[model samples]
Target: MATTEEIEDLIARSALGDRAAFSRLYDRTSAKLFGIILRVLKDRASAEDALQDAFMKVWRHASRYSANGASPMTWMITIARNTAIDHLRRRKETVDADDAADRLVSSTPTPEQSAVAAGEARRITACLDELEQDRGAAVRGAYLEGRSYADLAESFGVPLNTMRTWLRRSLQRLQECMAR
Candidate 1:
């Protein structure tokens, strides 16, 4: 249990990019932060994930910590709690997105729905065909085969970051084409 002055000193050192001080701060406070996250998240895995996020934020924003008579532990607790809430919200959004995706990709369709789907598929194909080089095939492989960016990068003989940029730009172009 570090004293408040010691914790403040550790944070100050961490702000100065002292890895040792940051490590000490983490050792001293991670348990309490993890407990706060767990209380909000209500699941071990999510709480653990939020704990890591909170610490990463603390590390990145150590210079932003204001010591205006506020306790260091309270600041960390606030960060952990907010991170857990954000994780919970993202989890909820993912569930909703999954539901929306299921509706979009349903196997069964009415005649009208089939007509709309056919038109959309034709538009998508047209947009994909408009893509120069093998971009279209890469997009299909990514979405249809559930392949990862790393896999695509290796298959296409490009760096991982390059593949990611290619995919991003390709998707943007596709979106622009589809909107027309």
Candidate 2:
């Protein structure tokens, strides 16, 4: 692992249009960067997009980054984090900086945390598993995929009222199961 000083030196060199140094920096930090973006965006496609934007900023504004102010990883993460938050803000999505900060702290799920998330996913899957197949599918379409109720109704070829009922019941059931 590179010390903070070594990393800052590399970043400063990269800022001067050193492609090889930049590549080395990216290699050392992409996974951590991607993980940070993923937690904020919560969508793989959006997170990947944000990661690209963040790296571009790092490339362009590398000179602005200062060693005394923040570590290299912290500087890179600030770039990534700000880029992601900017997207959300421009999209008129939630714009809570504190929430984003909290997420940054909690985002990196460890192996144990991953197992817990998987277990929760499994339990939720099981709960959905217990629902009528169509209803379960409808719930997944709306919540997991971020589809609106109307969109889900149209996709399922069902009446809006029916879709509403399905969503309502599915949410109630999920809440009940999760509460246990």
Candidate 3:
């Protein structure tokens, strides 16, 4: 790994469109960056994907990095972590009733175990059921899938403003429910 001063100097040159400097920076940081992504994603393929995306970001955003603030490695690690989280969120979008059923069926439970899970699920269901159906759906779609409101609006076939309203209202309702 390059020393901190060396990495910062490379970042400065990279910002000036020096490809060789950027390549050296990549060589110095890829292992640490991969490690950070792997910790968040817990899947080798996903971690590799995140690492690639993060380096692309580094190449583009090298000008924004500063030695006085975070070290280049830390900045790179943050990029990797965010990218992995984004991948996980996007991967979750396919989850819905059918998928949930499949997940439940794949894991059989003893009677006592089933009862405990049922009780917790019942409470959660009751709280969610209190919200209007659309509001509930909006909250679940955003929270569980980590999809943006814009994406949900497109999926819901509603206007973007309407989707925003649904999300805002849904959050308020959930807050009120949880408060009690």
Candidate 4:
């Protein structure tokens, strides 16, 4: 792990367009940053994508880090966190749009559609039941009750990021269970 001063120096050099400095910075920090993103994203592929995006932002915005008064690692973590959250928000929007389209096409479900929906609901419930109690509750609060992350975090008496991690992991578990 790079010391804060070393990271800061690398950020400074990176701001000056030193590709080697940026590469060193990445080598020093990518694992930590990727872990942070993975906690938010759950999916390794999406976390990898977010990590790449975060580094691109870091390269472009290194000049702003000093003025922001955060340590280099802190600044980089913020970038990674925000990038993962943005990815989640975009995914939610896309899901919402798809759901709306599905609704418009199926105001009244046929027998087959109803049966499929019932099976899906049961499968989701079974998956939720497989999770630890609090994780399952957090997943339900976030999805079924339409609770915001902040709201769920506060209710659960955990940090916002911890809440996100719980939900992400829970959802991943649910996905796996449903696939079976």
Local accuracy of candidate 2 as per-residue lDDT tens digits, 1-180: 667777787789888999999888888888888887766668789888878888887887777675224446776877777677666555555655332222333244466755555556558887887788988988876543445677779988998899998889987997678545
Root-mean-square deviation of every model = 19.7, 9.7, 16.4, 18.6
**Clashing residue pairs for model 1:** none
**Local lDDT at 29 for model 4:** 98
Better candidate by TM-score, 1 or 2: 1
The CA lDDT of each predicted structure is 0.73, 0.72, 0.69, 0.76
Off by over 4 Å in 1: 67-69, 94-180
Cα deviation of 53, candidate 4, in Å: 0.3
Backbone clash count for every predicted candidate, in the order shown: 0, 0, 0, 0
Question: Of 1 and 3, which scores higher on lDDT?
Answer: 1
Sorted on lDDT, highest at the top, how do the candidates line up? 4, 1, 2, 3
lDDT of 1: 0.73
Using Cα atoms with residue i matched to residue i, what is each candidate's TM-score against the true structure? 0.50, 0.49, 0.50, 0.56
- Model 2, residue 29: distance off in Å is 0.6
For model 2, the local distance difference test gives: 0.72
Superposition TM-score, candidate 4 onto the true structure: 0.56
Write down the worst ten-residue block by lDDT for model 1: 97-106
Candidate 3 clashes between residue pairs 3 or more apart in a chain or in different chains: none
Determine the backbone clash count of candidate 2: 0
2 versus 3: better TM-score goes to: 3
